[model samples]
Target: MTPYAKIRVVDASTGRGIPLVELRTVNGIRHVTDSRGLVAFHEPGLMDREVFFHLKSPGYEREADGFGYRGVALTPRAGQEARVEMTRVNLAERLCRLTGQGIYRDTLLLGEAAPIPNPVLNGGVMGQDTAQAEIYRGKMMWFWGDTDRTSFPLGNFHTTGAIATLPKGGADQGIEFRYFTKPDGFVRAMIESKESLPIWVSGMAVLGKGSNESLYAYYAQVRSLSEIASSGYLKWNDAAERFDIAQTFAKDRGWRFLDGHTVQHEGYILGNDPPNVRVRADAESLLKAEAYEAYTCLDEKGEVRRIDGKPDYRWQKSLPPISSTIEARLVREGKLRAEETHFLPLDTEGKAVEIHNGSVHWNASRKRWIGIFGRKGGKDSALGEIVYAEADAPTGPFLYAVKVCDHPKYTFYNPVHHAFLDKGSTIYFEGTYTAEFSGNEDKTPLYNYNQLLYKLDLNDPRLAHAKT
Candidate 1:
């Protein structure tokens, strides 16, 4: 008797049809499911023998089974299709590390495995932290906090500010070092002249619409290490070859700025009057002592209005307002205790888990807000465990988080999501990987004090049903 089979592939959790799933039979016949996840095939002289099927997809886990097993056997009736439910792969497995010239470069200009015995000049923008990546003008642009490696061997010696651009394709295509603050002749001159100004430019936020966009970089203005650290804001002047100081905090105010850390300028802008910007602020002594507070800003008249209705040119004068809505939801969902003063998600032990320099962005494919943050685990665990969380809205009731990547005995911080570089099912993010602050000096070769990329799939069931 002639044998024939019809198969329908679907997600195990959502039960939605998974398109383009490939299935191969033991007899060397291959069939790919269509948009509806249905595939049919026929073969003669196969009724007497047992048949097995192998399945494969990008976001779904692969499955293979031999004949005679009740669940694995393929015995489809004449007009009926056999349903094949494929489990979604975990987000961790889908993350692929990319290859590039690590954060530092030598005089020889070697690749990832270059030696650091005798470093003549600060090569390839030096080691950096808090990498902020964006896809601009058809290329990937990366801006990071350039550490002063000459000052100390430990991490984040001092931020000098760095920028690099990568060509199309992926990491294999290589990147071009565009700018470094310390190496730039003008910035070096300022530092050498003993000027009491900001030497490092970091915490960059790209603002404005297409063609009219501007890059706003943040700096801490200090004559000496002991002086009150103030938010020294700078705007990149393309016509001129330097970043000009846009705003500086008054010394008498005694305010320190913390979280202009990461900015989401796409839809958070409110009104047409120069557009109000939303900033995240962490409580220090300068502010009202509330942790992880959010503030609204208006950039039109060169003044930022705090939630208290006080306007000031300097960003520090504007105090971060409490986001009661998000705090209430988190408490209701048990993600935060009612007594906790911070807005970050709490661990099982009720400790306020710091996000450090995590990023939040919208996942268009999944129609949800996704975030990746550095989870501050206890001393015994890896300090660089990257956790993934999702929410219905940007300012969220982000209730649950799952650990996606665990680098035991190492330190990974400042996780940034590259939402513009996403390709439908697959999304990318990165962080500064090092052992400098982990208390254990053991470091991974070719990855110490450098940026590491992580790729996640939107179809992962763990992220899809994260709240559960």
Candidate 2:
């Protein structure tokens, strides 16, 4: 039996394996590095022949050869190994796949020891979507929408939950997940659905004192990808270790959903993507929709009024904060000018970096609010660009937004900055890396629609762009 040549791609400086590097043969045979940054090559016709391979990876670079081609010439031999090194160009360094199978597939295939104890499959889960997390019950409680199972095409759609010990390694070391699974071994629904529509959970947070601490999240029942039929809130049942519907809100309930990172400031939880809407940190205020207040410029009647063509940014009650969607509509309606917008941070190009979705947290090191957000309607690939920005306060004037991580032809969206995992100036974040919104149809094997973790140093000179 002939073993295929094992090709490995690693970071030139660290000599650590890099994931998602694309290598293409001169004739167009394409290969991507797996979680452990490996590709097992076995092209019989090209095995003996010296082939020119093109290297293409986002946030990484290799020098061009004499003919201006940035590729390597390799003569792959059976039962052998080859190595390629690339310099990480982006401030953010992609660590590994947080969800999905074959995390260390090729590394394991070569009989190498994996980083995590259970590298192949942790929860018997194939893949999972956007992660909503909170530090709860002395552990990191995580919930995700629409999980994929190894056994079938369909999977747990209501919600999937997992719990892990609070990360102490700043996420450079891969964190482990112990999934909430059913008897059949697939991830069980955090909350079972009684309707035909699927339930996707988000806005997870923990409330109350020590023994009285409780977990909660906002759930939306969807008729399709864009159409959410109904929305509601849920509470975690400590005894059953799952979520139960606490209150079902009407579909017209204005964007009072605590949708992203919830930061406690001045005894109130500032739920920020907008950071404008918030409720008192107490258990009772969080459950009541009317109790939440919006930091809006609107009058009591919920009307957008401009003073001398400028938005009067102020705190108003019972009104929704100007979200990205609302900002876009107001701009089109000539109610809000581009220059007066508050939430859309700007890149170095002086272009307003339209943000799709993201989370913000107060970083103690910087003493400023930091955000990791996905770009929207930019020249870059759709849903593939990520930007980092900071503000003096959680709600006002994000100085600048700069590119931190990028996926050339892939979609990496809904980036969640894990403030709980932050160590000094080093920040850890993760996002849903998928092919769904991306025009490319080639789903990354064992990795698509899953979370990919990345880390960045706030002191890095490259990030100085955003700081300015």
Candidate 3:
């Protein structure tokens, strides 16, 4: 009878399968595990012979036996499966590879080893609000706030709104700046009496609609110093193959603002139906220190219903009147509370950790809601750490934020998760890496005022055992 064995490789700590692990037998035959971390071998002639298996993978350390040899010697049993566990080299390793210089277009223009260093889009500006979507087939579009160079070294610059595209499906490839709203562009074309110019499209949600599957983008506009302005939509024109503000939509009922008060509509959109698409807006009272969020529904008639059921439209020239608001009804039914929508998470010290800009996504594999947010303050002060928290629900009492990445003297803000770009147990996220808000007067060359990408493995023991 031939000796046969089925081998499986998995992370020792988390018990999750580790794919692409290499295994070699004493007979010099080699094999690699599949996506499920499984591989099988059978040898007829060596039925009674003892076999030894060697395991190896990049960025991982192998466990040793009493003799310090790096393999496991085992006697095969017919029709049985054996499991081998491997440990990661460093689960909390904060390492990232800088691929290109400036945006994708700049990288191509200034080939490797160009005499002069490439300048980032609109001078030395950080890429904030890293919103990503696959509008077209296999093409990834990234929208961000182009904080054009500021005259004051320590002050933040206003955004002109820029976009870049990666056609190779991965962000690792070179990027090309597709659309960059100039200082004299439409976003900056209008001037408010007491407000600043260049309203920024800070938070955006790319949605699809209709039979032809046309795409539309809903964004939260903000004035200078991050003041909430209004909410509007943009339509994708197939002829131009670009997005344009739906002027008609904006003209009719797209604007939502308040006088002497801030009511910002920021955060992701959920649900599918056009009439019932849920908008999670982070409402901050700049006058006071109070900050909370609310869930509003966008009806087919372009009416926004507040959580309390009131039509929260500011202008209604020819629009229908809001018959009744849901506020009273929801309160009477005990379905809504004014105190439950606070958006910040608490740290280990029981202190509230303010979240400036981050992403929240449902991780079905982990069966938990994962949120990646930039910490407002820590050992390195504001924007020094990227925190990770999990919860049972999207709107959560997200507690015990774990410090995943520590940027001591650097500022990393607007950490966005690209769930659409996730690869198995490993997920990718990017944030604006700059020294603008770090209190560091000096800027690091080639890395300053650009975006940095990070890879987090969900199977890591630290992340797997993350507290809810």
Candidate 4:
């Protein structure tokens, strides 16, 4: 049915397909691998001729030949098969893109087998940002930040969402999403707004159980890049198929409110990294700011209590916990010592690691609460690096961390570990990958601003530092 040839890219060590591997001909014709690490290449006049392709992928490399070229010369034939092996140098195995078009585009074009019902495009969504998921109404619902479309660059910024049947197999297998679409087939804004500014949502979760349950989240209206104009709580309106504002918070009242991906621990909803901020998992309590508590080190009047230059930690209401960023600042200011901090995570090299955004979950296999987050300032690729750390308790002295994934020149930020996808020692996490903060101009087609899911094994020898 087609003149395309199948070129499969796989990890040399595991022999599994390597997604996002790029191959380009001398003429600059580019082909990128799909979720299965397969590329369907069909170039006019290049078929059946010997063509040399330069291979490039993040954290992957091929041995150079005597000519010092890290490429291969292969004779392309219609419907024929080829294979290229790349060695993975990163700790976490980069899997596939979860948002945007062309997820399985190449695979579907060649009439070959591919995952997902809609392979080329779904719900007219070309690109989307950091997605948050929740188990609601018998299915998993996804809410993302801003989205881009095929029609134009200035797309929906009012928040978009989708629902999908949770996949049964491991995360190594591909996953699919069916968006909540409008009449025009574009993904409709999940959170409606009268204002012209954009809105983003997080901390989405279901409160109560069974027939009395209701879904809720925290929404922020953005005027510029990330400056929040106003923030409030939202409740799902099943009749309208979108979120409705539950209550609005005054200035500075948003901090103690629920934020980030939350987890239910002992009948309470835990929010943010280290699981410090929490509230009772009930409708009435979650809506009340006085009901929320944070594992903080401040006095009742909101003043820091220091004993011998170290903070005194306790669970307090109406006050959010001190962050690693604050710890770093306090350490630099002689108010706190690096050796005695409770919240700051240190790398295996014994240096303080700044966490930009991440998720913390209780891992059953590791039996330790693990934090997987994006390293804020890294020499490797700015926000592209991911690090993993563990604590005996959710409130960490998550002291030692290991660099789990690395992107030399690309930015992959806001990593979240999917507790629902845990398969013993094998864990899955995803983040928004983009060129926005990396200072890189060349963005990978169909991948920029989409979530890239990664798999990390706790049993891997490289993760030994995080064991204890």
Model 1, span 16-97: residue lDDT tens: 5554356677665666554335555555654334566667654466454454321344765544457888776535432222
Q: Stretches of candidate 2 above 4 Å error? A: 1-4, 27-29, 42-49, 66-68, 78-80, 165-170, 299-310, 328-340
Answer with 1 or 4, whichever has the higher TM-score. Answer: 4
* lDDT score of residue 448 within candidate 2: 83
Per-residue lDDT of 1-468 in model 3, one digit per residue for the tens? 323466667767767555445677777676655324555556666444577878764334578888775776655565566778787653433222222234322222222221122323343343333434444433455444434333433322233333445435354332344443445432221112233433343334333333445444444455646554554545456655545665212332422221110111234343211111233332222111112112343344543446466434332223322211232234345543422322445565555555555666767677766777777666764685777777765545464566676566678776766776666666667776678778888555445565666667787667533464
Per model, state how many residue pairs clash: 0, 0, 8, 0
Identify the candidate with maximal lDDT: 4
Candidate with the greatest TM-score versus the true structure: 4
lDDT per residue for candidate 4 within 360-462, as digits (tens), equals 8899898888889888787789899899988877777777788988877999887888878778998999999899988899899888888888989899998
- Report lDDT (Cα) of residue 393, candidate 1: 53
Model 2: lDDT to the true structure: 0.80
Clashing pairs in 4: none
Number of colliding residue pairs in model 2 = 0
Q: For model 2, how does the per-residue alpha-carbon lDDT over 1-468 read when each residue is reduced to its tens digit?
A: 446788989999889779988889988898888777888788869997788899988789989988889889888887788889999887798888888887877777667777677678867788889888788967888888888888888888888888865334436757788899888778888886678578988777688878889887878888998888888789999889998898888766776667766777778887757577788887678777788878766665655766886668876665667676666667678776665666777687887777787888888888888888888865657889999998877775665788998887889988899888888899889999889878989877677899998988898887776776
**What lDDT score belongs to each candidate, Candidate 1 first?**
0.49, 0.80, 0.48, 0.83
Arrange candidates by TM-score, descending.
Answer: 4, 2, 1, 3
